[model samples]
Target: MQEKIKAFMDEVRSRNGHEPEFLQAVQEVADTVIPYIADNEIYNGKNILLRMVEPERLISFRVAWVDDDGEIHVNRGYRIQMNSAIGPYKGGLRFHPTVNASILKFLAFEQVFKNSLTTLPMGGGKGGSDFDPKGKSDDEVMRFCHAFMAELFRHIGPFTDIPAGDIGVGAREIGFLFGMYKRIQNEFTGVLTGKGLSWGGSKIRPEATGYGTVYFAQDMLLTKNDDIDGKTVVISGSGNVAQYAAEKTLQLGGKVVTLSDSGGYIYDKKGIDEEKLAFVMDLKNNKRGRISEYVDQYPSAEYHKGKTPWEVPCDIALPCATQNELNGEDATTLIKNGCICVAEGANMPSTLDAVHTFQDAKILFAPGKASNAGGVATSGLEMSQNSLRISWTREEVDERLKGIMKDIHDSCIEHGIEADGYCNYVKGANIAGFVKVADAMLAQGVI
Candidate 1:
């Protein structure tokens, strides 16, 4: 079994040797899914994994736009239509300088499983550009988005492929992209999630991922007859996922003591309350300021330069930051600090070693595919609403999001239970997700 998995992975490495991020994502799934495939004859003897690794469609194009200074800037854009056997190509579009084939492929690979775990009819895909939105004027950003979407519009549609927001792409960016798509196609469709509510966006879509991450962690605690009512949480990243994760934690009576950006993390021993979190929202969303300014508004907080929040002792940890941000050492530190639960809000936020360490320690750990499916799940919901041409209320959307997270948690337990009764979330997530996509692939008969 080991030899087979290794042989398959060796081929993966040969094809994607230059793509460490994508290779890492593939290896994680291969580690868990191969064993399950070996045990299931239905999935065995099929090169499904091989086909899954290769995307169904990978589109690359050039995006050219004029800056505010009227200077022309060209950037590369891509959309990896990973798989659509289950449904349309559904995923987020990230705009960051680090956006490359490797990272997008990794994200798209992870999205296949993540979207599957959502219990929604959505396949996996991811697209983005190396165009950084930071420090760019609204006009500049709009121009870039327009240029990018001009190319992307040809490939996506409501029932074909749906793209949402990630990282630097937010509601503002979504509006621009959708406007371009609508303008180009001359049609109003739900070709994208995370649209403005005034148009067709779903309620609570912004908070779904973070809220669902915390909800999954809350479910993890429930198995031990514990709760998040008083647990301290350390979260990385202050982006949409981190901000809303903290919001949900506060609502659940959890003390969120830390939120970080790439610059560093801010430790607020006083806990970032709703009011403080609102300040953070304004600071990051409107002001576009660094997290260090958090200390200025609330003197009780201390900003740690060039550090992550993992060093802070907490009962729970949510790595909402980018991939590989939490390493083995960080995992060790969290476990040693008495952390019991770790839910990933970002795609593959923990390294392979960090994940192994958590698994070895028998701690409750939920991978992003399971823990952070809320974003895309809600995107799926938005699609439904758009198809129906009606919208659900906030309460309706929130309840659905909570239910989906609970379902994902239950599914993890169903597949991830070990001999000693410990649930390996990564293993459970990979297998449960693989079963759905693999069966669909099999049914389609090598298409």
Candidate 2:
């Protein structure tokens, strides 16, 4: 099995050698899914995994726009339509300086399984541009988004491909992109998620990913007769996912101790309650300040320069930052500090070594595909509401999101349990997500 997995990955690496991130994503999936395909007669000889690795469509274009300085700027944009076996392409669009084909491909590949785990009729796709929204004037950001959508609009639509927000892309960016799409296409359709509620956005869309991540972690704890209540939670990232994750943790009686940004992390041992979390939301969303500013507001907290929050003592740790933010050393520190649960709120936030360290410790660890799926699941709900021309209440949407998280948890358990009675969420998520798309691809035949 090891040889087979290595052989498969070697073939993948040959094509994607320059794309470390994409290769890592594929390697993780291949490690678990290949063994399943070997044992399952129906999947053998089909090369289903091989086909899934290759995107059905990859579109790249140039986005040109004027900045506030009246200077013309050009950025590379990409859309990786990974798979449409289960439904039309569905995923998020990121607008950050780090956006590239490799990163987008990794994200799109992970999206395939994440969407499948949601049990929603949405396939995996991802698009983005290497444009930094941070520090840019709203008008400058709007111009960039419009220019990006100007080219992206031709390849996406309500029924074809729908994009939500990720990383540097958020409600403001989504509004700008959607406005351009509507004007150019001459249609007010559900072409994008994360819109304002007055428009086509669904309730609890912003909170879905963070809340769902906590919900998934709570379920994982429940397996061992544990819960989030009274647990000290350490969370990384101060963005939408991390802020709301802190919010949900507080609501569930968990003491959230930390939140971070690119600059550094801030640790408040007294815990980040609703008030502090609100400050964080404003600090990141409105003020657009560094997380180190959090210490200025709350003098009790200490800010660590150029460090992650994993070193803090806690019962739970949620890595809601970027890919490969958590490494083996960080994982070791968390384990040594008595962290029992680590749920990923960001896609591939943990390095491969970090993941192995966590799994080897036999602690509860939920992958982003299973734990952070609420964002996309709620986006699916938004799509449904748009298609039906109806809106669900906040309570209704929240309940549905909870149900979806629970269902994803159950699916992970059904597939991820090993002979030692420990659940391997990574393996479970990969295999469980693989079976659905693989079956759909099998039934549809090769494209």
Candidate 3:
């Protein structure tokens, strides 16, 4: 089995050697899914994994726009239409300086399984540009989004490919992209998710990933006859996912002590209540200030420059930042500090070593594919509402989100339990997500 896995990866690595992020994502899935395929005769004779690794369509183009200074700027843009076995392509569009083919491919590959786990009729895909939205004026960002959508509009549609938002892409950016897409197509459709509520957005769409992560953690705790109440939670990142994660943690009676950005993380020993979290939301979302400003507003908090929040001792830790932010050393520190649960709110936030450390410790660790799937799951809801031309209430949308998270949890448990009675969420998520897509591929006769 190890030899077969190695041979398969060797072939993949030969083609994707330069794409470290994409390779890592594929390696993680291959580790678990290959063994499952070996055991299941239905999947043995097919080269399903190979086909899945290769994107059905990869679109790359140049995006040119004018800056505030009236200077022309050009950036690379990409759309990896990875798979549509179960349904149409569905994922997010990211705008950041770090956007590249490798990162987008990894994200799209992960999206495949993540969407499958949601049990929604959405396939995996991802698109993005290297245009940095940070420090850009609203006009500048809008122009860039428009330029990007001009080229992207031809390849996507309401029934073909749908995109939401990711890092550096938000409601404002989505509005611009959608405006361009709508103008080009001359119709308002469900071609995009994460619109404003007055337009077509779902309730709790902004808070779904954060809230869903906490709900997943709560579900894991429930298995131990415990809950989030009275637990000290340490969270990283102060963006949409982190802020709302803190909000939900407080609502569930947990103590949230940390939130960070690119500059650094702030530690509030007294806990970040709703008031402080609101300040952070404004700081990051509106004011666009550094996290160090947090200590100025509240003297009780201490700002750690150029460091992560991992050193803080807490019962639970949610890594909501970028990929590879939390590593093996951080995992060791968290375990030593007696952290019991680690739920990823960002895609591939934990390094492979970190994940191994957590699993080896027998801690309740939920992967982003299972735990942070709320955003896409809610996006799926938004698509439904768009199709029906009727919006569901906040309570209705949130209720459905909770039910979906619970079902994902149940699916993880059903597939991930080992002989020792411990649940391996990564194994469960990969295999559970794989079986659905693999079956769909089989039924479709290898397209």
Candidate 4:
């Protein structure tokens, strides 16, 4: 570790206590940025890294709502307005049972750089509640979302901070939150992304993360004279990200054999075709159902209990679940089964050990900050559309998204091409994201 990074880590430890996960996230970015800062003297000793590590503000509040049973429930809501030197705070609101200060902080910190790497005029922030949307009735979810937004709307705006969807927050949740924002503010604006198309939502917003992941993976494969066509893909998670990742993989002529949920994975030997994927979308998205439902619907598919999809043999793997879902053992299993590429569709889905395993095995691995940046990148686009008072067509938005993914891929190679002629995408993404914000911070001086 570089001295500046070591000092920053020490500072973090002193202030935030010894939280291992938070430290790991910060260290990952620092390791990449310190080298670049050393090479560029203007950035050295500027404390940009330190400033980037600490958020501009963190807002936590109590969310009170009524369940379907008419029982009052209380949950914690958080919004870390991380940075805004380059532009307004921009990120997602994840509503999962596992959310906490440390988790949101790590996510917000990572978002700062991820937004920068998109070359979009946006900063970093993350907000969410510990409320789980799964198994909740629509009315119950609406009440929770309305409660969450009642507190959050005050901190966000079209030009201030923008939040999108992540993990447990989706179109349904966004609609509920947006309704509350509009009802309270008495204005119709782009306060949130991932909204329904009827309410100024951009086309392809829901599919961006997964589509972007595959697009990033496609760019990576292109470097080695390959494409997604005819490739075997194994993707984890059956959420929006994983579903669209599977959709795009098939669109690109790739065969996806596996899709998983928290319960387990479903393996389809003949590949999860478009019809099967639609069934899955209906089951998970519409019905709020389980992975086992897919097995019951499709007799050919085999459902495995308490196991991830990585055990399947594949040329590509996309982990679209929550953080640290893929560990060292999973990485080893995928690599041993001839997995050549692993792209993250979820935030920090791969553990440190898993990342090292992929890197050591020379598998093309793209970190979430780069691979899943499509969602935020498109969020930035949505902001632009709102500002311009025009909505782009799905094809136009998708085309722009593809361009942004390619640009991110190019940016990574430009910054982090390693000695072995492989692009260290993680380093590239962090450095590229850092330099932009660092320059902006330097120009503005300390804040």
Candidate 5:
């Protein structure tokens, strides 16, 4: 069994060796799913994993635009149309200095399974550019988004490929990009998710990912006859996911102790209540300031420069930052500090070693594919509403989101129960997600 998995990984590395992020993602899936493939003859000798790894279409183009200084800038943009077996290509578009083929490919690949778990008619895809949205004015960002969409609009459509937001690409960026896409296509449709409420955006779209992540955590806790109520939770990343995760934790009667950004994290021993979270939302989303400013506003909280929130003792840890932000050492620290549950709010936030450590410790750890799927799931809901030409209320959308998360939780448990009676969520998520897509690919017959 180990040999089979090793050989599969070797082939994956040989082809995608240059793409560390993509390779890492493939390796994680391969380690769990390959063993299941060995047991299930339906998937054997089909090379389905190989087919899944290679994107059906990868589009890259040059994006040139003028900055606030009127200086010409050029950046590379890409869309990895990974798979559309079940539905249209669906994923998020990131705008950051680190956007590259490997990262987007990894994200797209993960999206494939994440979408499948949502039970929505959506496939996996991811698009992005290396253009940094930070420090750019409205007009400058608008021009960049227009330039980016000029090339992007050629490949995507409401029925073909739909993209939402991630990382640096927020509602504002999505609006600009959607505007450009609408102008070029000369029609208003559901080609994009995360629009403003007045312009066809779903209620709770911004909070879906964060809220869904916490909901998944709540489900995990329930398996142990536990819940988030009265639990001390430490969350990393102060972005959309982190802020709303904190919000949901508070609503569920949990103590949220931390929120972070690139600079470092801030520790609020008193717990981040709604008022404190609102301050953080303004600090990050409105003022665009670093997390260090948090201590200035909330004097009770201490800002930790150049450090993560892993050292804080808590019952749960939610990593909402970028990929590989949480490492094995951090995992050890969290475990030593008596942290029992870890839920990922970002795509592949935990490294392979960190994941191994968590799994080996026999703790309840939810991977990003299962834990942080709420955003895409709600995006799927948005697409449905767009097709129906009607919008659902906040409670309606949120209710459906919770139902989907519960279904995903049940699916994980159905596939991931160990002989010892513990649920191996990672294995369950990989295999369960794999079966759906693999069956679709099989019926399609080697496309």
Candidate 6:
């Protein structure tokens, strides 16, 4: 195990030239798998783990679109097909300024195990663009989506890679992308998830991540006979995942006091209720405006520029924003304020130091791979529905999602619980996710 870790580290350093984000992501999984591989003879000498770490194919292309002012804007788009021993590649396409090859590779690498953890018959992949969708107009966004899909459609299909929404990509963006794909391919099919319900979209798809995060957290709390009721929660990001997380928290009798964007964060000690949250939805989703306007609309709320919500104090924190949004300092503040549980709704939201802080504090922290897997799990369901040429009811989808979350929680405990009866969800998640992919890779005879 030590030798493999050294070799892997050396290989990464030699090729990637000290890319910390990519190394950090690779090391996290390597730390889990090396020992497991060493212990199991079947996995030894197979090079399956080595091959799994590298992507099968990576696509990068120029996305050129004309804006409302008739000017040409160009952005880079990426799709990292990380692994496919299990099934076709499945993941989300983020459209943030931070999108890059390294970031997408890290995300796709993580998605390999995450999809495996869902117990679904889907492989892992991730794609996104460097185009910031923040201030783009409807027509501009449509044009951009069409242009992006013009290249991406060739690489994706219902039985092949399927892409869904992420940071900047939402239903509207998915609509435009799917529309372009349909036009190019000249067919109506489920090549994407998170579609409008009227289309081939599955029900509860939009709410899956947030609801599943809370549900997984609920399962964690139930280990100690606790629940979300009457708890003070702080959630970051005002996007779909954050909004739905806040909604589910409130539905479970929790008080959610914070929501943020790249601009800043909003702290409402009185809890972001349905009406206030509705205003946020209108602000971000409908109006496509800045989060600062949330303060203007609700005078009681205070918006802090260039700050996170951890200082506000809470019992739970769900980081639904982009990767590395929660650093060690935020983790310390949350611990100081007595945060008990942290579940990730976004992929790799917590930095390494923050993760260590949570572990040191002995707080129940479920990594995104185990906790926020509902989105992709339901995506697998969407695939199933498409294969059968049918659509599922909202209640049916929601029920299936809940059951999957519970199953993932159980899988974590089954694999990650230590001798002291403390469940190390991180270890559990990595090991459980790894076992499936590792076995499949081994059986495939060194592919």
Alpha-carbon RMSD, each predicted model: 0.7, 0.7, 0.6, 1.3, 0.8, 1.3
- State the local distance difference test value for candidate 6: 0.90
Q: How would you encode candidate 3's per-residue C-alpha lDDT over 1-447 as one tens digit per residue?
A: 999999999999999999999999999999999999999999997989999999999999999999989999999999999999999999999998889999999999999999999999999999999999889999999999999999999999989999999998999999999999999989999999999999988999999999999999999999999999999999999999998899999999999999999988999999999888889899899988888999999999999999999999999999998999999999999999999999999999999999999999999999999999999999999999999999999999999999999999999999999999999999999998999999999999957
Worst 10 residues of 4 by lDDT: 15-24
Tens-digit lDDT string for candidate 4 (279-341): 999988888889888888888989999999888999999999888899999999999999999
In model 3, residue pairs whose N, Cα or C atoms come closer than 3 Å (at least 3 residues apart or on different chains), thus clashing, are none
In model 3, how large is the Cα lDDT of residue 42?
Answer: 98
Please give me the total number of clashing residue pairs in predicted model 1: 0
Per-residue lDDT of model 2, residues 1-447, tens digit only: 999999899999888899999999998999889999999999999999989999999999999999988999999999999999999899999988898899999999999999999999999999999999888999999999999998999999988999999999999999999999999999999999999999999999999999999999999999999999999999999999999899999899999999999888999988898898999899899999999988889999999999888889999999999999999999999999999999999999999999999999999999899999999999999999999999999999999999999999999999999999999999999999999999999999888
Candidate 2 residue pairs that clash: none
The superposed Cα distance between candidate 2 and the true structure at residue 422, in angstroms, equals: 0.2
What's the lDDT for residue 230 in model 3?
Answer: 99
- TM-score each candidate: 0.99, 0.99, 0.99, 0.97, 0.99, 0.97
Over all chains combined, what TM-score does candidate 3 have?
Answer: 0.99
* Candidate 6: regions farther than 4 A off: 1-3
Q: For each of the candidates, give the backbone clash count.
A: 0, 0, 0, 0, 0, 0
Residue 182's lDDT within candidate 4 is: 96
Please list the residue runs of candidate 2 whose C-alpha ends up more than 4 Å from where it truly belongs after superposition.
none
Provide the clash count, candidate 3.
Answer: 0
